[model samples]
Target: MTNAEPLFDPSLPGLADDPYPHYARLRRTDPVYEHPAGYWMVSRHDDATAVLRAPRMSVNEKNLAGAPADDSAPPPELPPAMVEATNVMNLSLLDVDPPDHTRLRSLVTKAFTPRAVAALEPVVTELVNEGLDRIADGGRVNLMDELAFPVPFAVISHMLGTPPADSDRIRELTGRIHRSPELLDEAELIEGMAAIEELVKISREMIDWKRANPADDLLTALIAAEHEGDKLTADELVAQVLLLYAAGHETTVSLIGGGVVALLQNPDQLDLLRRRPELAENAVEEFLRYDPPIQQTRRITTGPYPLRGKEIPGGSLVMVAIAAANRDEDHFGEDAGKLRIDRADARQHVSFGAGAHHCFGSALARMEARIAIGGLVDRFPSLELAGDVVWSDRVELRSAKVVPITV
Candidate 1:
């Protein structure tokens, strides 16, 4: 509704508010809808899954070196800041291919194992309790601002060894970076670039500090990692830290914020969840399927690939719409459109992506969501919307800017 038309336009400023309706139409009609922006949009769950799992589909955009000046002079060398930024970006596990990705992922994989996540349950619950207590006495509050934002912010900050003093500022910076890195205009992009410069500086200092004073945190683990006796370079370390800042809280916030908003919209489901709190597990799964945090991710085809009965050319850009795929009736049966917490296949939803690129932080995200949602309902069974809801003005990551509510 924010846009003039109802068609699913991923480029629309307000499409993030309610993209599901358009996604449904696409799934029913043009499962392989091609956007005018020169990209194939794979909507069906099966097709999206195939594209994601395809080894030929790659994210090898690591060429960040020179910027051309003019015909008169030679290629202008990248500035130090830009070089550092590029280094920070390229070393990310999310952007590299197999061998590098595998090595980088292994460095911190132990920290997110099931047992490790289970160990975090009590810590997450305590954080959730503190978040709730901040609004326990108030008649109304913006859940996104108070609980949803702070819970993941605090958890991830602690995990990364970010000082409590810098948590709020870092949270603000990370929020802008992760919400829709691909959606920023030139002005915002410049501003974000400046912010990243400052963040890169701070991250460098933190890495050095962690080296001197090792701790039992993910940062320390990453700082100590060595790939076949070849440690991560300074730029690589900086890049990994920046990636964490960009990704850590955004998806978790989206999950919690979107789940709370959706439950408010569907009180019947909320009531069902409240009565059988054991359904918290399934409820979190359904919430992810119903309204995922990160909607779509891009992939570049290295060879001709057939999808939805069409042969996409070798060098095409395809958007695997995770939001659309999750709700595809062909994949989720007749009640695909409905929010049923008890849906058996809810956990199978591609909200976290698929194949080798499946989210590295999924277990941590799920644990946080379950504890946050379960603890909230247990604390305030009478929670309800208090004011107008405001959705983030983005399409890639669907999240509420504010979910005003009364406890």
Candidate 2:
């Protein structure tokens, strides 16, 4: 029904803010779409699930921009900064395949357990309440700035045993790497990589400290994690911790900001939530379904795979659109497009992805949103947008830079 040749272009102006409409059109017409550049996308719910869980699909692709390679193609001269950026990209558990991914993720899962996350609820509640106290004196405030950003940043920091004094600088450093490196200039890109290196150094020092004086924290637990005569190396520990730090802080920030805006836009659902505070659990799920934090994640195929009954070639980048799949009518029923806070199957959405690569911090994210979003509605029933909301203008991250609200 739509004539858009490339529906998945990232450079479009408003694509990041509202991609569901585009996703709907594509899902109806072409569920398995391939790009001229050999990049394919699987947008349907079942296809998304299959591709994510398929043995043929791989996450260990070298997606570095403007970097040297040992392949057949002639090498191009690249700046040292860009090469350093590529090196940092390689350090992530995101770019590794099994055995390595299995090892790192097993250690991470042990530390980021549901029990560990549940124990943090009291502290998370106190953090949200303190933020509320600051906003109470001021009738109007930017929730993204005053509340949403700080709460998760604090929680992840506390979990990692990162010093409280270094919170602001660490937060600033993490902010530098949230967006794509290609979007930045030479100077900005260098600064971002430097921030990453600095964080790695900080993590390495902490790992050493934890070894000496063990504590009851995620970092200490990661240090204590060991397999049958095998354990994480120094670099693996630092990299995994950095990955956790980035993923933990960044995604939760998007959830809180985008979830609050969703409530403001739907007054009836907002009122229902204010009336029944317990709906917070279900509300968090719907918010992720309605507008997921991460839009698409890229993976490559190792061999031929069938998608939507069509066999695509091997070794092509398949961008799985989580935002689109969550909105598919076939999977979520007739009212899939609507933001129903009480939707029963809301938890079935792939907002946190599926299978092995699924987000490790989903439990922590949902709990934070329920407590923060739910607690706010309970305290300030009069919460509504003060002015126009501004979204983060990027293709990958679906979030807001500002949400002006009056409580």
Candidate 3:
């Protein structure tokens, strides 16, 4: 590992607002810097990829040091109810280990297969057009609220057979739960948990309803999936559905939001994409590399592992800074900081992650982004930013709370 000093604290304020600079420092200085937040931060491309792919690293919370013996318990300041709901509903394919993760992911992967996502292209295109139609007559629109957020939300909602009318409510609940970990005190955590409980209730009811009368949706698929002659239990079904609903929409929302911001900031890149509409796909890849939705993912060391001459004990936390890895000079070249839409190595970035936990819905997310972005430029050639951008204070997911733009 390169000997470099860590520039910014991952836990500092406004860090999420712009972490690329900090990531750059970490990559150049301390590639595997240890953070006081109780984790080793891997900022370099190769190091981050190694941690992500290493079998010794696990997503299971059980590996978290000093964590409650009951995996269902919330962290120190979190409310009990919130902890329980988080433990129950958050146990999707992302939070488990090999056999469990593999089994759970396999059961849901069929629904997100390339063919399945491709089939939704027309539908996604139509949805994008509809959203654009709403804003076509507008003076200004918050792209996140009006376009970016709704596109993925609608797509995922339809995939799960959820009514379009319920999208806003679901979004509110999930957004709260996602941001709860960043809250200052136990009270806020309690409120966040309450919101999560409500989400759980809604998800559970939906699963029950789907079970009674199955539909051709992902929820129905998960409800029907069997492993070793046994089907997913009610709790397992609730957990998986909730996880899908949150993960399926939230990250994509950020990608579209961040992608729009990236393009607007780099007019040259934006102009190039507009000129070569075919480059929409490449642009999406660049968007992911330049400004990924999910910035960091946590892993627990399941066994003693030697990384960059440091021996980390089992149960130690490892925070992989994906946003940093994408911009690593070693991986993307000296001009990595420059936005090159035509960069041949752009798709090699780790925005959707790598290895066993690579995003299953990456293709779907890309399809939505391509059609939505390409269609926007086609319909509104004069599209431009209308006001200051306001980003979410979320650490894990980087997104704009509001991106005012004009058609």
lDDT for residue 129 in candidate 2, whole number 0-100: 97
Give the number of the best model, judged by TM-score: 3
Q: Say what the RMSD of model 2 is.
A: 3.7
Clash total of candidate 1: 1
Please give, for residues 181-204, the per-residue lDDT of candidate 1 as tens digits: 556776786666666766777777
For model 1, name the residue pairs that clash: 88-239
Per-residue CA lDDT of candidate 3, range 260-312, in tens?
88888889988998788888899899989988888888889988878889888
Which ranges of candidate 3 are over 4 A from the true structure?
Answer: 1-6, 72-83, 180-183, 226-229
Question: TM-score for all predictions?
Answer: 0.90, 0.88, 0.93
Off by over 4 Å in 1: 1-7, 62-80, 179-183, 226-229
State the lDDT of candidate 2 residue by residue for 229-342, as single tens digits.
376765666777777765568789889999999999999999989878788899999999999988877778887877767887776778888888999999999888899999
State the lDDT at 204 in candidate 2: 66
Q: Point to the candidate with the largest lDDT.
A: 3
Better of 2 and 3 by TM-score: 3
lDDT, each prediction = 0.78, 0.79, 0.80
Count of backbone clashes, every candidate in sequence: 1, 0, 2
